[model samples]
Target: MVADGTKRSRIGMGFLVGAALVAQPTAARAFNPFGLFGEDKPAVTANAVAYDLQVQGLDGKSDVLTAVRDVSILYRLRQEPPQTGDELVRRAEADIPRIVDALWGSGHYAARVSIVVGGQVIALDRPASGPVRATVDSLRGRALVPVAVMIEPGPLYRFDRVAVLDQRSDLPFDPAELPPRVVTIAPGDPARTADVLQAAAALSDHFRDRSHPFVKVGRRSPVIDHTARTVDLTLLVDPGARAGIGGIGVSGTKQVDPAVVRSFIYAERGDPYSRRAMADIRRSVARIEAIGGVRVREGTALDANGQLPVEVEVTERPLRVIGGSVRYSTIDGPALKAYWAHRNLFGGAERLRIDGDLFYFTGPQNWPGGSNRRGFNTDDIGGRLSASFLKPALWGTRNDLLVDAFVQRELTELYTSNVVNGTAAIRHRFTDSFNVRAGIEGEIGRSTDVLGRFDYGLLGLPLAASYDTTDKPLDPTRGVRVTASVTPYLGFGDAPDAFVISRIQASTYYALDDAARTILAGRVAFGSILGGSIGAIPASRRFYAGGGGSVRGFEYKSLGPRTLGGIVTGGMSLFEASVEARVKLTDTIGIVPFFDMGQAYAGSVPDGSAPLRYAAGLGLRYYTAVGPIRFDVAVPLARRQGERPYAFYVSIGQAF
Candidate 1:
């Protein structure tokens, strides 16, 4: 093949030169080479030029040569036609230096390239347009060019020695004394220019992360030894003075008080300056959903007291917002929800929100002229209204206090009643990845179901905690999440009852590839109510599976123990598990195939007596920067009477 390409290149060059030499008549009318009569063109017209690329003088097929050829314009000219043969020659000549540079980038610094076209040695450094124009002036019409690129990649260069010179030894530790945390390449490793440059950058970042924000790295020169085929690098550094926290300033906050903003700072005055601590402060401030943006400025120079002055600037989001959503499904015909919130109530970064939702508004007796109530009752008109308040840094620490009050009337497969409740909770984050919460709640309600009708009052204590190591909360391709909570309730009204409800859930994600285009996700949850009969506990507190967020094939809260009349009486115990493979078919589109199984039982422990529900389905996802828009369709593996053949769901984010 090499010989054939060489022979073709020689012939191609000869043809071009011959056409130019025999072009005296065409040169007289160069401006209009068509014909003297303007319509009588030549019968023998030139064809479009094409080339055969060849790279020689290599021990084997080298990746460096492949990279060069892949990026060569000479090779691409065949796919993208050039106007003339001279233009083709110019591009081929220009690619020689580019090929050499690419070879050097791949660690072959001592590489040579030679370009031969039609048996003529074209000067690799010839000006692109000047000489090519003069040569092509003689040639007319179309022509084919055979090009050969011969490469001689010499011995690869490796690093011999790498050192950094620190001008200021006044710091606590010398650069030489400390461990090499930035140097990536060692002696005898290929001398890649990228690795050398990256090492310098990492070293500079090391000092900046260690409180030397003003540090500067200067004068980087790698001395290359051509004979030994090795590179020795020396980098000069000037690390300026280290600093301590001098003063903290907050600005750009209108509705949020300065004290609220200052509370996020992890470092106090007189403390040694730390970039990590400053970053934490920035993150803490950003997490306050009310904050639109945050900018931190470190003092360019230390103060007279030899400390740094830090400024925290933050823009506040709109203090109030009102929005709502609409949803529908076969189980629940239609539902609408509306909510309003004040992000910075009373200028303390406190939040107050009011929410209202109406469900089954167009079914049975809930709306006029309604008839399709197969899975619903005539009185299943349900609505809820609630108000909640939140205070951050309640005690000048990473703790939050929440207070809530709500009144609701609801109807379900199990029962329908009106209820009112109040709750108070305190949440504290122990670290960036772990947190705990404790709360107390009181309730009063009336419930009417197949069992009977009763009025009840209850008081409860709830404690919960979680550990999250996922890289992202909305969409995670890796890491684990775990949560456990227990709430104990004591009934005080006419029908007195008591129960302790506990739930534990966990999920994990693993990326099958580096790009995170494919992920295997799994989840499992267990919940139960101890020390109480299934009828005694409120229907809202009972455990049931089968919904968009649960076992998908079944209806919402429809998979559980039932009354003799066939009404679903939500169970006292629950267990569920799901596995999904999320594969991104494109940058914005993805597909998920999943399997789910779970069971709800009357007793605390989910014994083997009651059969578990199983479901398998496929889902589609349209990904965006914020999250994915999800659409799922699921069918039961084990069919049941009266249940729909399949279930369909639409929402945001992944199922897990």
Candidate 2:
């Protein structure tokens, strides 16, 4: 067998180069390569130029030399439109070098290849391009490349009985899929290397796309030989199966439900080995109720056919529930409190929180300052309970049912009050990037007027709707959210002439990272009491903005109309706006600094006073799987003679 001029230099080795015409190994069967797939493998004239693929000192004469592998097979092929036999030969002549390298890397160091005249690379049709049965026909023996080197495969390749070899051989590859999630074999036919690989690819894709995203499926080639002109092969495969959950075991971190992680796994005891399920499960081990990122995958495989004893290995995270400190700011003075919380409380994304605070404050005796408070005695205790149910795949979307109940009753020089409320709602996400929500809610409560004398009762039903899609709810990276709600007495006509009450809030955020990891957010909320004797609705019912979650600069519910005597005085309406930059500095920390503007009035700004109240501050946050721990210290820009320079806050998650 003699290669064209491009062959290795027999002369370079200073040896006599004889052009030996070796006998045809055997007549390749008369069968057509394409015909094996039930389509005719068309024959082309063997007219391409013969060439030798030369490598430094390497001889192509030895039968052991095989093709070398290239990173991207497709990239190496120089496409030559097979317009005619001659042109096809030219392309083949040019590609011989790459082919030689490929052959060698593939283990055939001395492979002898000859192109049938007008040789072409044949390819199978992708199922979707056309009918499966007919598509292969249309693509039958079609040339993907012209002037190709091919050993006439006597019997074309077809899958025979497959055997899996591994130290853990008990868990054989799923044979049903031929190339189960563990391995795939090309349909027995006149197969090309690419087609065979396409079959194998499904194994990795199926596993990664579902449970074992991190799994690495390395290639184990099928040996082929056409000496008898019959190429037979065996597939070498690695299960790459990781630990799956055998049976969930629980201990110390029991506050959060283990079921929460179970649902995330979407896997069961009998599920395939998975690392992801365990990771997600471990996140619920914490005490705080928050959102955290987790990865799941099959872990140690039990060498059993898909029926392996899966192991759920979790890397537990920081405790979610933390007994912590609390602090707040007010127009009167600054105060600190003690707090405790159970984050992943009932497990599965539920939260239980409690807080107790005490602060000493003094206020100026003036109409604008809401006068008459020079005191150091202030104490408060409050808590919140929230639970949620999330079903992402149901309803053709991700939907959630949430319920929350809260009470903040306190006795102070300012007031002695009791307030209780419960709310149930539904939230639906239409897209990973967009959301719409609507719900019906009701609240009933009573509280002491700031002066500790005037007591008021309030009852109302509120309807609300919102649209938003920020990366992080509390600290959004991009997108805008609009929320508006109105609470009206069930029957105004039958109830005390309380006409109608309404509140509206809107917020927007934009991501700074081109990747949208961090964001800049701004928000504004305005509310008013409208209807018969709106004043009768009580001080608690009147809308007020401020504190850690609201305006941030002032104390909670402190930004509203009031008298120098610190009474409800009277509230016409309230308006609050704030600008903040939410930075996801790292996976573990987030920070935000903001400016707030807000105020309350009784119909009109008392003739000569500017009703605008402003505060600005910086916040530090610690990121946890359960969201973030927040701390902010805000100061009022315009002090009313005797207000604190700064108000500090401690809480869970971002203020808003």
Candidate 3:
């Protein structure tokens, strides 16, 4: 019986230690480096009590108050009150050093903290007196214990002097020689612990960027002058031997060939070691669909070749993936899309995907010359089937080959067509943010429009370039994205013509605050068909704007030029611009108010003959792990005759 009881005590202690380690914040952890359990004490069972925790002397110091509250075990676990007054006393005792550290971290180096439990002052310098013990003992059967925390936040410490020195020589660098941004800590600036530590890290990075792979910020010695309320900080840096790239290795590759993984890394042997190179290597390896995660490890010391050795560790994701999405709009009806992909084919990180989509399930069935009333009809349904193949690192580490083919039938207000198209392209990534592609595409289709029925076969060469610096793909808060593309085509069969289509679009985002809770985003786009007349070009090849992705207030493809007989003919030129203010009301929810303007013209360019349509709307976003689920309600600011008063849309991700 004794042995069993001992074992149970040990187990309970182990659980408590684990929980404390996980629950405590960084400041608390630093104060108690060892596990929280000093010795195993038997669990005490007493009636839980309601308690009032009052923190004083921080009336105006909200920052310090918040920090203190965050690290207070009594405040954090208030819902589950301590079973005994002794346990409460222990918790208050444990919080003393943590609270002091929190105060010091916020530049209050001379701060003092005290605690009074149940009207008994717990002196920091001495153990509890007889009367204090008696007061605590009297709370054995009480239902309440009022605790007060008193803090004396002296003066805020400012930087007196800051210096960076060589670890071995103990020689300080001249202040004038160091870069302006390297030593962020300056005299007269608040000597907050975070700023001091950040300055040390910045100094270390400065040397590391200059080819010091093993640079270390060895020690930070701070001397506090209490009388002057200032701190003098000195950072010791050990910039190890300058090194170059040594042996590059890859590990954790299961199905992917190790050699193929190495090909994705752009860093070469004997190249000067750089932090940027390691980041680039990590990104390149992660770009592979099969690679779930990547870790670039650097050797602690230089290798036999006097260069830094790098090891690329990667975790493989599932080989096969299947997913789908659905979207709907008042004007375009509902659409369902599904796809299945093989991330790694033949162990080379090659990807192959097949997709199927059904759209316009219940939408307006307006033939070339018919009424626009919405209705459901089996014959009006449109669907598409497509397949795509990607071969990464085809010619070199920076290039990839892409091949795609699709067959689809469309039923729209302006035209009806069944088309098959195929494209082969080689995309070369110049950098993480920039890429360019040139491809050859061919399309064969037959369509019936307001003009008449026509069969056409077209061949085109398309060249495109994209630059994106957005922080996130689904929803971005900052940076810009620009894309330009031009495709020259030769039409054959029934509709013989030559045309060149050129388009350029740019979007930018600016975060209004550091947290990015509010963002201002804008976009502008322009497109023109230089050669072919509007009537000669295939309806599918022409530009049309409206609906969910374009001007949201209007119907799908309803913003372009119309025929005299009331048939809607697509445009040869297009222009679009939109602005949005995305504001997050909560972590998982956001609201966006947006304005959109654009027009499609019969002429080859936007000649100002046609007026631009305007729309304004408010959108609700439910943020998720993958992206935001979007719901928007929009109305045309300048509603034309016969146009709907408002439109609503539901989809995933941001509108852009």
Candidate 4:
């Protein structure tokens, strides 16, 4: 027999939040809020008594029953025996309202709970546990109590209809303005009470983002039908007045000019209030690593003229830092890198960094910088050192100036060589989607090939333009990124050639689902050197395709034109294409199947005579906070006489 309790009225659905509730389910997982356990009860002290609480008669609604059982205080009382039997009975009696709350949370409003303690019944409506408490106290002083809780969770309530009632006639109202299923409480679905309040807030935010600075969501009780098991909702909204931008101020800046902070703000005075504009400014400020914290506040409430003032506060981070990393690969053995950076060199968001790398401690020296000679040896080693400086906001525009210099010696399929290069570039971002750069570089290098040794100096002017709409640079799931660059070189010494090397590369990605669990990515690139013969251009300057970042199955630069001695001759033209299907099995683990093809032509342009090399590969990725750690192994599908049958690559980022 169940005791009838004084049931509280259901909570009315109404506007409560500043933003409209989207239908997106934000709950990570279904939870039993009352701490219900499927396992045996935990052991208690020998002196302490225990209670066995079982929630019975769940019918087919295990999910709802679990939610109520998990959070029920009666379960807690069992875990920790009360001081007296009467106290245990009292605790159970006082917990009926809380149990009802849990049932409501799961959209079950017509639930009834019956409690039986030691064969004595407890009434939920009586001011106390009454006769059950008296009987329990008389019979047991410090004995274990077995409690059985029988629950009857009736039909779940679902929203039959939902509407927004705009009370003010001065403001425009269109039913279509609200997002589809914003409340998430649709007809025929469980009407979660929380979704109703969330939807109200979402509606308010929708208007606020559109210049309604003082919009308000009012409260109203929803109409609940017991017989039909449905709820009808009407959300009240008071859109105060449309507002415009007012005075803007900046503060909390030290060691950085106030003008620089102000420069990042995109909103203008007297313009319509825009949340996107303000958010963009905040994002830009965060891009400067030196700025650690930021707060954007509306300084004034809506004025008589409907203007809201704004203020931005910033906290500066440490200007300088030092960090390093170490990586090991079967191809390169072990490599160590270290760097120091000054993010605000001149206090204008300028950056300066010095970096160095050392590798090839015990690997084959036959690769670049492995040895000073042409032949392969195990003792060959390579090292690199470089420095770069970047000046942001060049000339008060969204442009940057970069100067870089590097010296290194490395091995390639053709030869072991030493190179020194210096470059200066100016990059201008027209918008988020497009950018262009122009730069001049000078290089001096000496290299040895199977044929002989060569030395040269060169100067070049390089220009590049790109359009990127990818969501993430490290691992993009959607959008296209295209980049094209041309470099005109003037060589000095024996092989003086005024050749223009041009290249265009493009990558496109498409996510197969809303969660981006599966992605299709494709890439293609083409390059050619003009006005110079194969021998005239330096080996390092010529194009070649192979290795981790290129045709994976082939050895580094081994797929290009080759001499009679089987040595790779760097080609005058190059073409490469690849496609990968990336599938994320879990949030942190992913796999990719890829195919690659490339051709390196001896002539300035591919005339179809050069053989194309094809490779197929599988890759694994472990997603991390910074990026994915990638491991890939590939095999040549169309193997050539001298090409390695397989190749493997390991790196810290995506291949593309």
Candidate 5:
């Protein structure tokens, strides 16, 4: 009867959580709002109990037979609730049934043999704070957030009687702490579910501290706890102190060594059980070239002696993918780009990507820059290669490496420049919240008919760091990334004019509200050149800030340092800034109304040669099975000191 009861309870609980209320909720996981905020504030209000208590998955239809009621019982462990005020007493009376009903819906209590009542219950809020801290209010000199909260019942009296459940009769650390007061089940006293859970957790953590993280402590609730306020405890145990590899499996594989695949599994023979280590294995698997949605579920088998036989099952996802896009806008005209990438191209090791982007006019439009081809047109074809590795970061940190190369061209120019560039980078993810990346970049080539020179290509090094506490990556509700990098040539090497470039970039995204889920995104980047007949930064690197990456109101490459005649004036550089608000309509698609502002002093792309470009417009994004395809029609909100504000953009990917 007991076993059957537990099974039915689990089934009912699953049915409720899976089939009740809200259909198609937000994505699988939501970034924690309170945690993302600067700091977590107590949920409990000063006089009242709740500051932000979300009654998640609350169902109103199950109250009939389930008779779910939220209840809070008082226990005498620390202190008991007063038999006092009408408000506290009245409120508790009303709230108790509600809480009790809610918990009854909980799987544990759902199938109790007694339909109505059997055990007394107690309800209390467990507030967690600075933990084992050397001092209070200490945020500095910390490697991680040392504070946490947990809810528990029953002061699980420590025990001397504990045995390995697996070994059947194996013994370790005497069973002297066996039975004491409250040794058997008691009525009215809520079962010590929390105590069992906490004990298991504490035991697991104890093993993790030494980095041998592979010890699995298996326990199920009540987990059969017999205890009273004052009683010694006995724990039945399951011991597999050592974990061993059973074998391995593959997902999304072309041709990679099974041994190499096995390496990603941080858990190994004799390793201690560790959730953290398992998580690392998952991340590494996802990062393995050409794979998506990589998920690793781990389990263990027990021998007659209670020893654990480790088993790891793998599920591989797709890596090589091809996709095409079409978008229409006023500024970019009708644009399309085709891309192909192999996450795990040849094997599960390296990354290879190829893209061809073409920009054209919807109609033959006259430009301020006189006879510039029939209409706006440009084409870019590029490929990048990256090899992953871990490197030591400054201050004893470690980071990953990505080395890449690319080549591209200008289709409409009277003078076309074909260029080649290569870059090597090391990025150190210092912690979950912070990281730094540094790299060296170099390029060599011929400009229009500019003579091809390879005198030690100019070196570009970008050093950057970022902090993110947000829950999601691509669709962050709140987060910030800041960067600074410089690439100076020894004067584009003895060119007519010697020019060097330096730039700084900053971007931030914040959610306006959770219920409404509104978002605000902003960006700013400054680029300038120094020295010689060297010439303005190449239209490529000189920095064009107004379009997609900058002020969405502007056109691509259209918004940056430019001169009259819609030509990038021969000298000088520019800085751009923009802010926009985004509203997500669905998981994949959204719309944004934005105001754009920026300018160009030296070089230029079509759209303008003015010192300031102003634009305001609304953009629409359709989230597809593959990714988001975007379209925007922006008109100048106000005429700039020297330019026109009418332009449209259609493209894939976020504006920034």
Candidate 6:
């Protein structure tokens, strides 16, 4: 029998003694810094006394045995021996119903539990009398107590009948009409409480997603029959009137224009109400750099027009931000990058960002004791500085204006170039997953390669289109992404040429399990430079592969045609493919085993001027709220004469 808490408190000193014993730490327990009664208190103590806890009658039902142990206070605290036999007996008595509840949750409606302490049986019907006190007193001086929790988990109950009823009409839905996926559970299925609750939730979502904003899932009723070992369950659903979109309100605007925010929302007055549309509205609004957070709220009651009104609440991020990052790879050495951005430059959600990257302090071939070792020079350093501006709603809410300019100096094994370039483009979003951009670009540069130094001026028109359905930009668990681009250029000065460059790349992700613990991902890319001779094309414009972002194990730009002097000169065509398996070992940690193959070709197509290179690697990922931190190690399957044995890379986000 449980003691009355009110009576125990009135008997002040007696209650305090029991509370102290339960609160204070002993040799068998450690102090909980969170609080004596904090919800995070450890269920099991490390220093608890040794005790035998036998769970019987579970047969081979390991899952049920695990469930029982999870909820049993006697098992959890067995190591923390109570200060008195009375406390121990009280704990054992409290665990009986909890154990029964656990059994019921697993479809065992008829269950029995028995607990024994020392050599005494604890009767389920024992009263709060002198005999109970005598049992406690008899074990008071015992150094150790043997405890046993015996359970008779009865027959697992299965569903005999399942029904869904509309509360408003007080009519049951036809079982044949209800979708099996939505209802989840059916007759003859195990009547687990979890599955029953999941079905109720799914039914509510099915209606809510179909323009019913006020859908409600009423109480669930279950009828159990111990004799037949079966349960009859029914769920009530209340789907309110269907509604359309009404007035939209915007709030929490500090610096951004409210009209601009509203324009980004996909919903319009009188449009059909849809959960997907609301989600799109949230995503579009949140994409603005000025917005830190966004929330879409639907009114509880329809307006006079019988349509739902929505409120858009937004939180503004800081207007100015300065951030930087560092990355390293055994092949590329070390790199440092930094950026500064003005999110709301002119108050209409215009964005301006300036970025700088410095890389390759020491050339890859100059590493100490290498085959091609050389001393470092200032010319070995490479960097780029760029600035970009974006004006949203340039023509309409779906269009944006982008302008960019950059000055760069690139030093690699294949070439060295210094260039200045600029571009102006208009990007139009046809839908959330699709977009296209067309732009005019101008470049003036001087480059040195195996063909020798030359100065050139070039003007070009560039166009690109992309489609993406991945769940995340940094790390994706599903969906496919494809991008295609074409650029045509006219050259002047020392090298005069006319040429076009076209490329297409596609990648896809698939989750192998429902929980996304395992994933299969693949990528393929191809590019070609048409109409221009190898010597007439700029080294920067030529195709090249082999690096952390390409073949992984090989040096950057080291897998193309070579000059008579054996120096890599890049190529006119490129092809690459990669496949990887991502497996999670724990919630926050994962491992990826990947294979990559590709090569650059000297001709307009892969004419087999050089055989394709192949590499294999393993990666580690530390998942976080923003993205996963990645570390990868790779080795070439077929080692070339001059290549390193292996390479390692460290950075953030997935390799793709």
1-656 in candidate 5: lDDT tens per residue?
Answer: 12232222222332112111111221222123323311333332223321111121322323221223223321110022222222222332333334433343342232211010101111222111224121211222221211111111112223223333322354443334222221333333333334444555655554444333355665322222222222122344443344433333445444543443554454455454455555655665554453444555454454454334444444444656777777665532556677776654445344566666555543223332123445433432222222233222223224456666666443222123456777778876645456677788777654531222223235566566666554344455677866665544543553423345666667788777754358888877666666542243343344454555566555455554333444542234566777778888887668888777776555322234455766778888786654557787777666555555566666665566
The list of candidate 2 runs beyond 4 A from truth reads 1-408, 412-414, 420-445, 450-458, 490-496, 515-518, 552-558, 564-572, 582-593, 603-610, 617-635, 645-656
> Each prediction's TM-score against the native?
0.66, 0.42, 0.79, 0.80, 0.48, 0.78
lDDT, candidate 1, at 329: 50
Model 1 TM-score on a 0 to 1 scale: 0.66
Instruction: State in Å the error of residue 502, model 5.
Output: 2.7
Off by over 4 Å in 6: 1-103, 112-155, 165-177, 186-189, 269-272, 304-306, 326-329, 364-376, 495-497, 585-593, 607-610, 616-622, 631-639, 644-646
lDDT of 3 by residue, 1-656 (tens): 01121121221221101111111111111121122221222222256544566676665677777777778887777666666566777788788767877787788766767677777666345345566645665665554566677677677878888777888789976656456668767899987767867776887778777789878885554666656776676778888788999999999998987766876787789988888788878987787888999999999888888999999999999999999999885545789999999999978888999999998644444564233545545666788999999987774467889999999988676777889999999998776778999999999998878878878999999999999988788898889999999999998987657889999999999999878999999999999998867778888878898888888888878888887765568898999999999999999999999999988999999998789999999999999999989999999987978899999888888988
The stretch of ten residues in a row with the least summed lDDT in candidate 2 is: 13-22
By TM-score, the best candidate is 4
Q: Give the clashing residue pairs of candidate 6, or none.
A: 48-79, 49-79
Native-to-model Cα distance after best TM-score fit, residue 200 in candidate 5, in Å? 17
Q: After best superposition, candidate 5 residue 276: deviation in angstroms?
A: 8.2
**Please, what's the RMSD in Å of model 1?**
10.8
- Model 3 scores worst on lDDT over the 10 consecutive residues at 14-23
lDDT, candidates in the order shown: 0.72, 0.46, 0.78, 0.73, 0.44, 0.77
lDDT of 1 by residue, 1-656 (tens): 01121111222221001110000111111111122111232232355344444545543535564566566776554465456667767787677666766666666655656666654555443334555444443343433343556666667878788777776652334545446656667889887656766776876777777677788875444555666777675666776887778888999988777776766665678876766767766876887767889988988888998888889999999989999999885545688999999998877889999999988744333222233455655455678999999998775677889899999987664557789999999998676567899999989988776666668898999899999877667789999999999988888764437779899999999999978999999999999889868777767767888888999988888788887867777888999999999999999999999999998899998986579999999999999999999999999887978888998888888888
> Tens digit of lDDT per residue, candidate 2, span 1-656?
33233332222211111121111223333222222211322242233222222222122323212222132122233321233434434443444444543343333323444332221322211111123223223322343221223432112223333444432453455555334444444334433454345544655555543544344443344333333222233444454544444554433333435444343333457554433344434442221234343333333444444434433333334444545455454443555655555444434445455555554444444322132444432333223333333322233224555565556554333344455556665655443333444455545554455433343344455566666655456555566777777666642222344445666777887777665557677888777666644345555455555667676656666666666655444355777788888776788776788898887666422222336788989888897777778888898887765456678988776665
Off by over 4 Å in 5: 1-254, 257-281, 298-348, 354-403, 412-416, 422-442, 446-473, 492-499, 512-516, 533-537, 560-572, 584-591, 601-614, 619-633, 640-653
RMSD of each: 10.8, 21.0, 9.3, 6.5, 19.5, 8.5
Query: By lDDT, is 2 or 4 better?
Result: 4
Task: Let me know the TM-score candidate 2 reaches against the reference structure.
Answer: 0.42
Winner on TM-score (4 vs 5): 4
